[model samples]
Target: VLKGVVYISLSDNMLYKSGSYEMSDQAGETLNKIAKIIKDYSNYDVLIEGNTDNVPITSKNIRNNWDLSALRASSVVQTLQNKYGVDPKRLTAGGRGEYNPIADNSTEAGKIKNRRTQIIITPKLDQFMDLIGKAPEKS
Candidate 1:
């Protein structure tokens, strides 16, 4: 296909242990699948976005859900780069916390659904050969 992209939704139940950013074994496997997609679609960019429930983190340093989400996203980005040889430059790590919840936060199930880490793979705009002539030069 011409436009290659992979968007995978990792539910909160499939994530790392509570209060940690390390992915579970199954989550690691999912990350592996993501890595393979990156390797398969050469010249691609990966966006690792972390999301969290409306609940706040009472941990010592994790003052808010934002910290938790951001850290999780960073952790995933590190995993892809360190374990899978994915170029660091091609990866973007970010977090939406409870701001971009995909589900309601009023119930346990909804909160669980609200928490997630989305791995989005897409062709890098600047690296696309086909877009070479379509894009305006920087200078």
Candidate 2:
């Protein structure tokens, strides 16, 4: 956790097949664990961010990495809401494409490291605002 927010990073291979946005068969068990966390933190909002390596890709359905990343994030959000009963209002999905790489994308190992999904859980904005309002004002 950072600054009162919880971040959970899941490797792409754990969630999807190579170059595919469809969740892998084994993704359910992992997602179930995350869903449980979301349910436990009722006051927090969830952000699902999908990221990819620098490699270019083109498929009949996916035009590029951006499309793939977005579709992947949306898929996770849908599953969390539809299957896990997480509140739709508390979830947000974003795609970083190949821009936000946590590791070098030059080698195969680096590329593998770059492909990931990050689940961020943070307290609601209202709670943050309330804390800020209670702080001492600058002179």
Candidate 3:
């Protein structure tokens, strides 16, 4: 059996429009499949993280990559709760912006790869509390 958290990562291009945070229809379909999986494993909490390329973004709606990323993450969480019936308490949304890059941002291909979203499903740790018992005090 898996011991701890299981993370599911999805790219932003697959979920949203370029320079936008709205979830696309295709994203809905993909999220539906994910929702089914979450339903079966309802004991876990989900953390939706949004990441963006280093390219600067400026718009009336968005202040920067951070705002854009955060909104994207929030949008995913909202979709999971509103459309998929997932409990709101089990969801968290965070934006990493252009800071954490998985690829070289010098190339278009790399930038595309960097703009992404990650869904991390962490199993509740309460089940192991008994095993851990109490920690010894520091010296």
Highest TM-score scorer: 2
Query: Lowest summed-lDDT stretch of 10 residues in model 2?
Result: 127-136
Alpha-carbon RMSD of each model: 4.5, 2.0, 3.6
Single out the weakest 10-residue window by summed lDDT for candidate 1.
1-10
Q: Which ten residues in a row have the lowest lDDT in candidate 3?
A: 127-136
Report the C-alpha lDDT of model 1 over 1-139, residue by residue, as the tens digit.
Answer: 3345678788755767776676777777777877887888777888889999998788887778888888999988998899889889989999888999877899998898888998888778765666666767798
Better of 1 and 2 by lDDT: 2
Q: What stretches of model 2 exceed 4 Å from their correct place?
A: 131-139
- Model 3, 1-139: lDDT tens digits are 2445567778887899878999887898889988887777788778899999999896788999999999999999999999999998989999999999999999999998899998888766784464246645569
- Residue 15 lDDT in model 3? 92
The TM-scores of all predictions, comma-separated, are 0.83, 0.92, 0.87
Task: Give the Cα lDDT of each candidate.
Answer: 0.82, 0.92, 0.86
User: Candidate 3, overall lDDT?
Assistant: 0.86
Tell me the tens digit of each residue's lDDT in model 2 across 1-139. Answer: 8766899999998998778988899999999999999999899999999999999986897888998888899999999999889999999999999999998999899999899999999989998788678878899
Per-prediction tally of clashes: 0, 0, 0
Relative to the unseen true structure, what is the C-alpha lDDT of residue 132 in candidate 2, on a scale of 0 to 100? Answer: 75
